[model samples]
Target: MLVREIMTTRVVSVEPSSTVKDAALLMNRHNIGAVPVVDGGSVRGMLTDRDIVLRCVAENRDASTLKVSDICSHGAVTVSPSQNVSEAINLMATEQVRRLPVVDNGRIVGMLSFADIAREKAGMEIAEAISDISMP
Candidate 1:
């Protein structure tokens, strides 16, 4: 199956200039852990709940004053919507990422997550991916 076959098409994203609090609020409202940071019609970075906690809260930075660009992880690993599920799995495992932004024409079109893979009944792949991601 292709990434577009299982990816979440309705992606919720944030701007690079958006506040950390705004990103966190979006995550809360969407019940998601991460938000793609976009700028000028392109994905610039990825902001995660862990990024807020560890980079802002843990560092005593005010989230309201901080920009998503200040805490977001840049150069995020991405996949094409046309890629196969196995390719996505391999990229996830190799990159130690739980999610990948699905890009098309330099624009983010969707998100592919480990949960999406698991829903495809690829339990062993999920397990292996998780193990690789969690490795020390």
Candidate 2:
């Protein structure tokens, strides 16, 4: 399986210059924890709910006036849509990240996550006696 098999395609992104408050609001409305920060048609960073709380709210910075570029994680790790699911999973595990933005042809096309793959794999009822039901 590949990330393109289960990644969310209707990804929502924000400009790096967008205010922190705007980003948070979009996340809240969509019930997402992060947003890709784009600049001039390229992904520059990733802004998560934690960034808002830690960089702005917790630091006494006004979210209304703070730019996402100032608080977002710059040079975020990214994944290619054509890569195998294992590679994407390894990247996330190594980085201790929950989500990975998918890039295709120099464009942000989708986002993949650990839970997405786990749930997909779990849903397959391939064989009744494939293996013991116990873990070693």
Assess each prediction's global lDDT (C-alpha) against the native: 0.88, 0.83
- Which lDDT value does model 1 have at 99? 86
Candidate 2: list runs displaced more than 4 Å: 124-136
Top lDDT prediction, candidate number:
1
TM-score of each: 0.88, 0.87
Q: Find the 10 residues in a row with the least total lDDT in model 1.
A: 127-136
Candidate 2 local lDDT, 1-136, one digit each (tens): 8889989888888998899999999998887788899876578889998899999999999989999999999987889889999999889999998788899877888988655765677654532222222111
lDDT of 1: 0.88
Q: Candidate 1, residues 1-136: lDDT per residue as tens digits?
A: 8999989999899999999998888888877888888887688888888899999999999999999998999988899999999999999999988889999999999999887888675677775776466332
What clash pairs does model 1 have? none
What lDDT is reached at residue 107 by model 1? 95
